[model samples]
Target: MEGNLAAVLADRADTYGWRDRPLFHSGAATYSHGEVHDAGARAAGVLRSVGVRPGHRVLIALPDSIAFVAALLGTLRLGAVAVLTGPELSGREHAYVLGDADPRAVVCGPGLVPRFTSVPVLTGDDLADEPASLPDPVPVPAGAAAYVQYTSGTTGDPKGAVHRHTDPAAYHEAMALGALGMVPGDVSFSLSKACYPYGLGATVFFPMFCGGASVLWPDAPTVRGAVEQARRHRPTLLFTVPTWYARLVSGPEPRAVREAFASLRAAASAGEPLLPSLGDRIEEVLGCPVLDGLGSTEVGHTFVSNTVTRRRRGALGVVLDPYEIAVRGEGGVGYEGRPGEDRAAAAAANAAGLGAGGQAAARIGERGALYVRGPSVMIEYLGKPGRTADALGPDGWLRTGDLVHVDEDGFVHHHGRILDQVTVSGERVLPLEVERILGQHPGVVEVAVIADADADGAGEEAGGGALAAFVVADEVAPPVPVLAEELIGLARERLPEHKVPRSVTFMAELPRTSTGKVRRSALGRAELSRNGDGSLR
Candidate 1:
């Protein structure tokens, strides 16, 4: 089939008689499937009027709303490649994207119309009032470039991962249909936005594929606002990151919160590993299972997940059937640590019982870098060949850059990013491990551990290099010094001496990218850096 995403969705709505069903529920407004379909057709007319043609990139920087959905589908129907970015990003960030994508046109929110004078600009207002004029369906190969979803940019500059027309349905099949049998009765409420693949899979694709409604709020939601929306919409599927889930269960698990989540059958967390302690609290409050999944922007959506039927606590679940997951290393060992340091990581895996891809038991408990080969994997990064070559090989295997240990039961345990390993003393300490330990502290709302360097013997404690903790706590009884001490003590009790953070700094909030991933590189810089006396650097 010469497939188009807009046509496929419209077909589903028509075939299933879902035209009357709500597809999007925005603030005080509900848009039906048929209405959204007509809106997409009208949006296509708007884009075509502005001279956007097939294969041309149309950068979309709209908030989460039906307009965003319609514009995306309209771009697809016109055979244009959609480029997504967050509307809330800074002006500098938007300029960077404009330089990178060099899009033929821009579809932005009202607040951002002033920033795109270089390109033909369109907004939701343009699409809303346009007469319903359905254009002829563009006939393009299924493998044609459909959209570009940018990386989270937590480490550095973001790269646009180009996805094909066939990828979204593949995501729906692999996760929504395969992991959790989604139904028309389900309603999706996702905290992640449309600019992210996690949000797209949960809110736009998953629910739409199964004829369910997606709750779309234009703003980044607070805990109170999210709960109120859930109460109003009564969503059955909750999709968000681990940090948001942690916030949802903090303090008193209020009656309103529980009631809001009472209709939910399951909540899935990605972006980072869900701490088991936080998961327990989330499930307890919501009275539903919280499944942890892992995926990347390049792979479209989750290729590995824990479903309600088969969940392994604290581990990224078994690989989905649509993808092949392999852990690669030197001599069946993980390649992230210094020299033979990862030998201990292999040993710990062996102790817990390990095996890889039905290989020999002697190679058991191997720790290594993960590689995923999937149908939805991006063909390339938009325009950067060098960056694309570094991450993806000609053989179609994507170098995931994540380290993991696979158990006999096929559960994948995340060991943080390979680049995040901190050399504390002679031992290698993954900051995520220390961060996980520190997160258990009652006073610690959020914590990010990073390797910090100082002029004076690494601040006189960690010998050459030290691990620093950046924390966020809103309502703590103790002073900053006392709470820092308490968190350090807790880490010491839970982790090895070398693994524990050497110093602590309190922050109002950790610097995060658009996707909510902590900026470890920015953690100990500028005003975030600290002195021996606990003052900013």
Candidate 2:
């Protein structure tokens, strides 16, 4: 971890000789690297004037703008932790976060000024009124906290993932750009707001690290808005979630959207498992690979991904070497077959032969569960020690609830979540895998899979519930029979016969959380209530 993130940005400005190039662009304006550096300095002066000390928390709720960029750098230059939140956080969530962080000051647009009562508020316009230069970087220790981003919480209270000051620079330099093959000229755009970790990394630091341009559109809720932004800016790369992509592709040809992205070298999807067919369709439509990677807010950025060189339909690619990932089970950490020791013995034992892309099947084995140790892991869950310790072990290996297996070639394949796993006719099934396959159908726009139960605990309610599917389709007619047959066929092809969906339902749309993820628990409960005989309840 570097002492401070500002040093990294400054170093990029010098090394890439991009001091004169545009770093931030919007529909109305553009700011060069030198101008951005100046604005950051000025914003730092405003922070200093406000008595912002090193280690102070400054809640920033500015919309994406030049001032937002400056305020970000300003917070870091002052060695302060910036709480990046969207302007439209719910009043209750906003109040809870403000009280939780107890920031020394809160900066936002005038529209949100009245909501923050605990701390004095500063507007972006006010910062612009002040000189637009920042002080030199303060030396923040490598272990200093940089930001606190909230993550999805099942317990009703939002949880914060505290990132180290240096994690951003390290992640951008060592992992995201270097590992993902991001070059100096790469233009990165993200639909997620900067308050989120994925959006921050993809939009802010990814471009800065490579001396590339970062595109931010103020209007981003609708497909048309995103398409307009893309048409105007023509980003070389896009980082978006599955929901937005589904919406974009489901609409008309989106020809302007496609043409704008004609120069796109790479596209990435996250926030959930993208249907492989959706990925293939995106590649076919946009003429670029829609690489899917996996990460959580706690993990900072994507640690596993489907790279261009070695793309796989449903795999989240190999864990980058910088990260130490192990599939732990009852035995211990599973080891990949090292070269020269077991190849001949395994070959002699298995001549029927699974070759390339196929490997021996195994359960969660003695390794226990998925444990990851790396610089990218969050330091803590703010004030939730019980939850933190339950997930993060003493060895710095975080126990991701996901159960997976690394094949002989060391590629990781995701299984169902431990808590959400189901058994059909004695075979364990991962609902996400089946959902991904269902989402590939031409008519299917989105899908959610859940276990359905009958009330009397008889018939289909044998083991909690049988598998049920909820789907939303594009203009194409609902392929109910075709979908069921194809889904069953896919299950048979990729999984044991028992894991296939017993029934499928068509819906106008699957329910979604505010963040655009399908709410499986909601769907599960709804299905149980809808199908249950009432005995289970």
Candidate 3:
């Protein structure tokens, strides 16, 4: 615990005796535990030769491959902070991150060298020439800064969440050991790339902690590629987002795809709410439980999750032990005790239609802002003290800005983000609620609801804004105009009058972040005209 995060490789090799066991696989090549360790040490030497030092930041922008892992661990071995970013980031985004982090050295492929004219650039080819011997590992305090993980920037400019050296160990214990029940001989595959927190946990930390191996795809993971990899590698666990799960179930070959997943013991979903219908489909097809949970870059990895032993279809499982969750109202009134309290009392009070204070308590059991406090949470957002202070409250409680409710069984249900809540006709509406109802339609493959300002200055007369839905239909679905009317009828039957979408537009696919969460901010600005009949034009 006193050493840098790189020590996990050696520690696992010692405890599990997996020196010659495969640790990483991409395409036809495989790297054993010992080989990766040696490669990391050699890469550390290369970084040292380029003047990387303790506390300095080293930007890692490479595809998901052995070289990316080596560069990350090598930086950690030297006590330098590894700044992880996707290789597919736009040039402007790359320039912003480079300027913000001001990394001392950059580790990337030769093709990306031209982007770092101001910084020291060390390509993978440079690491290839180094001696393949273990370099002396640098000793750092357990609380020393280890890495800088940037947020998805779906709502605003991306901010870097700074994590400590001990965070990885904490996440390993909470997620891998406590939640996942991982063990040796279990192969793991993740659709997420190594740059993100979820992928880092699945592909790097969990496997290392449990003495398992991970599959890395150099290219972006597609539905077909995922099934093919599963069939070939025979992994025990798979991690991905809800969007991918939906697409996989709706793919061309459902039976063959299910057969491909026969090797999987459990599958995990996050990044977005997992519709109960979608979860059931996945479980039926994969013949295993689909565990859905929630996590963020600020927490390093998952803090609340469902276990195979006790699974919930739609709800995020009980908060992992040693971590606490509190459902607080908009005014910061939290639940009195543990989340799983008497549901009878809560329901009775709400049924009575009580006054101010009683309504507040009732809402606590139904919906409120979520606050989390735990060891795995980040110390701060690098270089943004004001934003960090806004997120991290007094006494280590992090205001997650998510609207959630805790059921009597201690299960937490996500309503949506507080920022995502929009007022329509003087009533607050959560987009996820609308999207969830629309997602049940057979013709709808994906749906995102946004509040659009009404045209013709009708906002004050009808409501503050109008509700519009961006939808992705099934491959064999009907024409857009026909599907739009069907979706509208379905919404009228299931949702309230205000919640029903006033207009619908079809898209080939909903725009999403790299991690697979829908980009609602982008959808809010999408241009669409209202037809004479109030349908989308």
Candidate 4:
């Protein structure tokens, strides 16, 4: 387990013997597990020849392809750390990562070599030219650094989460094998790219670990691209984000799209919360169960997920085995009682639908900051000890910064990020709650809720700040002004006054990170003109 990640596949090869089963496919190109293993060995030899020693960091900036997989596995086989990054990074962003990581060498396509000005570049062709043979895999401790995965820099500069050599095994066991139940011959495809942790697990490690094949889409996964790939590859498990599913269901010819998903045994959604309505629509249209889960770069992969057997619509599902989840109240005190133990009793008591107060009371001790501890957690944030200390506590629990409530049955429900919460008239408002309500409207395609500072710089009640919503509407929907008014009316009927969005702005789409998460901080700078009649210009 400590030597090399490629060794996992090698071991499988030794046990079952190598076959020509497709291990990686992008369009027409396909590589068997044996081919990938041999390529990884050759790539490792090339990296070694370039002076990349054990423990040295090698930046991998290639797009999702067999080369990317070879580079990653090759680096791991050499006992070197692979610094995975998106190929679309700007020069400035590349500079920041290069400066922070200080890698010994970089493995990327020739097109991206110019971005790594001073760093030693080992192009894909360079690895291809090397001999396809190498010495035995280098041995390293289980705790040795494996890779540095950067966070989606939505709020600020991305921080690299350093993981250990044993993490991939832990992630495979807990998520891929345990939660996803992937088996040999089950083809998988992910809308998320291989650079991100979620996608890395789904499209890279999970398949390799389970002896299954993975379909890689080199281009961005638009609705059409995703459907076409699904139909072409016939993947049994499809991993994508909520936005893609929303688009697929709302796209014209949903019936045709549903037929494309006929090969899918199950579909998984992550990176953002899946609105219950959207989940229902997906199941109704595609005839596939949508398993929603939550994970972060810091955790390597998902530690909490809804299994195919025991699915939950809004809940993030139960925590995976071998991981501990705790809810911390005000002052960071851990809750003593089990979550959701009294959920049934509370739900029975509030069966009359009294109001928000009744529901609030039912959720009273259940809400708090979420914290997790497990073997799969990252070692630290690279070059940021203070930030690392603030996130990973002394006792080893990582403060998730997410406000959540656990029901009596142990289902974890995410409220919103702690930093994203805003106060309106002295009452705290969670954006996810409002977004969930607005997402139910047929006209609303996608929505992001944020607090806008009032003109007077006082609270909303004092005319200082108010809750604003940026909404993306359906294609055939009415004019923005009419839809805005209808949404407001719907919110008024479903939500409390404090929770209702004071203003609604229509947008072509919400700005999102590469992984499909809304950039809340960017919403403040969005050029949304307000009409005199309170309609979006």
Ten-residue region with minimum lDDT total, candidate 1: 332-341
What does candidate 1's lDDT look like per residue over 1-537, in tens digits? Answer: 238888988898999999999888888999999998888898988888888899899999998988898889989999999999999889999998988999999999888999999999988888766753668669888589999988988767999999998998877877898777789989989999977899988888877788888899888879989998998999998999878886777645556689888999999889887777677778888899999988899999998889878898889887776787667775443322211134556555555444353333334346678888878999899899999999998878899888787666667788888888767775677777887787777666677788776523453244556677887763633787788788889988998777777778887667777787887877757556576645355
Give the C-alpha miss distance for residue 126 in model 1, angstroms: 0.8
RMSD of 1: 5.0
The deviation in Å at residue 41 for candidate 1 is 0.8
Per-model CA lDDT versus the true structure: 0.81, 0.71, 0.81, 0.81
Q: For candidate 1, what is the total of clashing residue pairs?
A: 2
- In angstroms, how far off is 214's CA in candidate 3? 0.6
* Model 1 spans with C-alpha error above 4 angstroms: 131-133, 332-362, 455-463, 474-479, 529-537
lDDT: worst 10-residue window of model 3: 331-340
lDDT of 2 by residue, 112-222 (tens): 888896677888877765654556889887688888888755435777888887777656743465446887677777887776777889878887777888787655467
Model 1 lDDT, full chain set? 0.81
Cα displacement (angstroms), candidate 4, residue 48, comes to 0.9
Which residue segments of model 4 deviate by more than 4 Å? 331-365, 454-463, 531-537
The predicted structure with the larger lDDT, 2 or 4, is 4
lDDT tens per residue, model 4, 265-330? 888888888889888888888898898888888999887788876767899887776676767665
Q: How many backbone clashes does candidate 3 have?
A: 0
- Using lDDT, rank the candidates from best to worst: 3, 4, 1, 2
lDDT of 4 at 87: 88
Q: Distance (Å) between predicted and true CA of 160, model 1?
A: 0.6
